[model samples]
Target: MSDDSSMLLDGLPVAFADGQTIMEAAMAAGIFIPHLCHHPDFKPQGSCKLCTVKANGRYVSACTLPAKDGMEVENNSPDLNDKRRTMLQMLFVEGNHFCPSCEKSGNCMLQALAYELEMLSPHFPEFYPDRPVDASHPEVLLEFNRCILCELCVRASRDVDGKNIFALSGRGITKHLIVNAESGRLADTDFSLADQAAHVCPVGVILEKRHGFAVPIGSRRYDVEPIGMQVERPATAGTPGTRDEQA
Candidate 1:
């Protein structure tokens, strides 16, 4: 497939490649689109509706929808923006996302997206779900209370790391955390400290040991700007300031 085929997104003519998804094409064309589960290195799960776009007047997940020639895609329309904001709000209230206490406050994707949409407060009431925190691992912690269940970590663990240590256990609002193979803690599971899932989390739910509170909130990565702004930058160059030796 050619890398420069013409397509129409939101009534605007744009160039797209045949293999790229709608989100990839729109982002390559400098269009700002919101999404939660669409990581560049992982397969598209299309679980999050935050990146929904109108293609030929039908709503579809931009992360999974391929950009075909002559397709009309709407990305930043007012209605879509509202829906994205609302979905973010639901995520905010569904978990224990207390920005004041979280170490990943500034670097968190969910927090950054909320700020991008100017979500000053959660419109929905808090779910206050009581979930257990898994800190049994020597180098990782899993705080189920703060999880938004975007599933990026799951995919990273399963597909990228070849470790099926993480999986969604329940259904709907009653959903809770579950370990792989058995009901043991992450430490007992097949999860290794080197798994890509350890770093793909969008929230503080999955934290690295000896790394929490390493950087102050004001000095964190997303403090400079929204994550969308850094998406196009080189990963190393765009990373937030870290106290680690690698930084």
Candidate 2:
């Protein structure tokens, strides 16, 4: 019924409240919309454009667009998936994301999303941009090579942690994460391992030092179960994060 305050997501009815976005409603209704740069705690940012969906004949970011009653939302279509795949390919080529050598191989959202979408190969040529690794912090490693410019850490530090430790510099392809200190190092700032910014990253850009390979191969977060099945669906029984928290 139209009075039920529901929207048609991929032809299925999904109930949503007044303030909930399509992504939020879909997640709550057990529907998956591929997204990055979107955390439940932070305001919606449409930077990644991975969750683009055709709603009422127009394309919009599912993460930011509010779900209206009776609206038709096309999330899992070939055209939408193709666009998402192309964007993922650009992201892969623009950064130096060697998944095998990275610490967040299985747990990383980017890697997991790519796998879920069945992104066979990075279509474009790799940019291989020279980004520096900031190991100034004792417990953290800032590997800029794998950064997707999601700005999750930036928001977490500024909005949540009140530290304002991270920021984005430059424009277009030159843009990258920068520390807000005079020394331009993480150690110079008041950032710590316990900060919310440390754990908000969905990629391998920010990692805890000395904790690499702590979970071991084939037993990582997404290694056993896919990210969609893990995060989108509630843990049924005997799940790691479901029974006990991770990190």
lDDT of each: 0.77, 0.84
Cα lDDT tens digits, model 1, 1-247, are 6666767887888888768898888777777677777777777788878999898999999999888988888887788888888999999898888888887788777888988877778899988888889889888888888888888777877887888788887899987657785556888877775666767777777777888777766877778666667655223212463422111
Q: Weakest 10 consecutive residues, lDDT, candidate 2?
A: 236-245
- Model 2 agreement with the true structure over 1-247: per-residue lDDT tens digits: 2447999998998898888999999999877788888888789999999999999999999999988988999998889988998999999999999988888877777888889888999999989999989999988899999889999889989988899999999999899989999999999988886687887788888788888777776787778888777645332123345211131
User: Any residue pairs clashing in model 1, and if so which?
Assistant: 10-73, 221-240
Sliding window of 10 residues with minimal summed lDDT for model 1: 238-247
The TM-score values for the models, in the order shown, are 0.89, 0.93
Q: Give the clash total for candidate 2.
A: 0
Which regions of candidate 2 deviate over 4 angstroms? 1-3, 232-247
**lDDT agreement of model 2 with the native:** 0.84
